[model samples]
Target: MRIGLYPGTFDPVTHGHIDIIRRACTLVDRLVIGVAINRDKGPMFSLEERLAMVEAECRYLSEATGTEIVAHPFENLLIDCARDVGAQMIVRGLRAVADFEYEFQMVGMNRTLDPEIETVFLMADAQHQAIASKLVKEIARLGGDISHFVTPTVARSLMDKLGRG
Candidate 1:
């Protein structure tokens, strides 16, 4: 089976992320959404919350796309996570050239860590290219409407968590 690892903090899984997930599913037989435990980011949502949201969002993707997409939380190095999940490739979403610079270095390092593993970059949909989790959280915190950027469930959760609701 061709398994791909799409790892991210996914603090609130924005539409941009959903876009990447949908697109990535087309390239792999099995896609594992690895939610990283990056405490450094001081996530608005807990790991469990983030995982739950991702699970709910991606629940139908497997059935619809014919790709088994599962969400897993990992604290180890991404390469280690890939190995643990038997992922042959790592899927990343690039919103702009700025994303390429960072992702380019990341893939290079990942390749060094595990030469057998490969990384594939998928461009974000034009409409979603500007949607980012950080920006979404900031917008929600400031009482901005995020319904357009995220699913209704996530939008409500963000508002409740940020005291904007």
Candidate 2:
């Protein structure tokens, strides 16, 4: 069975994220969404809260896309996570050339770590290309409406975190 890993902080899963997950599902037997535990980046939500939100968001995806969706929180190196999960592919979403530059380097490093593993990049839908967790947080922090960028559950969670809900 071919398995792919999509790793991200997923501070809150957005509609764009769901779009990519849906697309990745079409190409892989199983897609594991790996939520990285990045201590460097202070997050609005706790790791446990983030994991639960992702799990809830993905439940609909499993049914709608007919793909197995599994959520895991990882603190180890991404290559290690891939190996542990038997993932032969790393799936990423590219929003712009900047993303390409970063993802390119990451792909090269992952290849060096495990030559058998391959990284695949998918371009985000144009509408969501500008949407990111950091951007979402900024908007929410400033009391800007983000209902259009994130899923309803994610939007609600962000609002709750900002004490606006």
Candidate 3:
């Protein structure tokens, strides 16, 4: 089976993330959503919370697309996570040139760690290109509507998490 790893903090999974997950499903038989435990980033959601959100958001996509989508929490190196999941490819979503610059460096580092595991970059759909988890949370925290950037379920979760509801 062709397995691919898509790693991210996913503090709160946004539409942009769903877009990438949907697109990545087309390329791999099994897409592993690597929920990174980056405590340094001080994510709004805990690892378990993020994992639940990713699993919930991806459930329909997996069933509809006929792809096996699973969330795996990882605190180690990204390449190690890929290997642990038996992934042959690492999927990344590029929103803009700024994202590319950072991803480019990551790809280089990942390649050095494991040249056999290739990195694939999927450009976010235009509508979701501007949606980011951090920005979404910020908007929600400031009492702005984030319905456009996240699913209703996620928006509610954010509101509940931030005590806005």
Residue 82's C-alpha lDDT in candidate 3?
94
Question: In each prediction, how many residue pairs overlap at the backbone (N, C-alpha, C within less than 3 A)?
Answer: 0, 0, 0
lDDT of 3 by residue, 80-103 (tens): 999999999999999999999999
Residue-wise C-alpha lDDT for candidate 1, range 1-165, written one tens digit per residue: 999999999989999999999999999999999999998999989999999999999988888999999999999999999999999999999999999999999988999999999999999999999999999998888778888899999998898787765
Q: Which candidate number maximizes lDDT?
A: 3
Report the C-alpha displacement of residue 117, candidate 3, in angstroms: 0.2
* lDDT (C-alpha) at residue 155 in model 3: 91
Query: How does each model score on lDDT?
Result: 0.94, 0.90, 0.94
Query: Which predicted model would earn the best TM-score?
Result: 3
All candidates: CA RMSD in angstroms?
Answer: 0.9, 0.8, 0.6
Relative to the true structure, candidate 2 reaches a TM of: 0.97
lDDT of 1: 0.94
Candidate 2 lDDT, 1-165, residue by residue in tens: 989999999987887788889899998888999999998998888899988998899898899888899998899999999999999999999999999999999988989999999998999999989989899999989988899888888888998898888
Which residue pairs clash within candidate 2? none
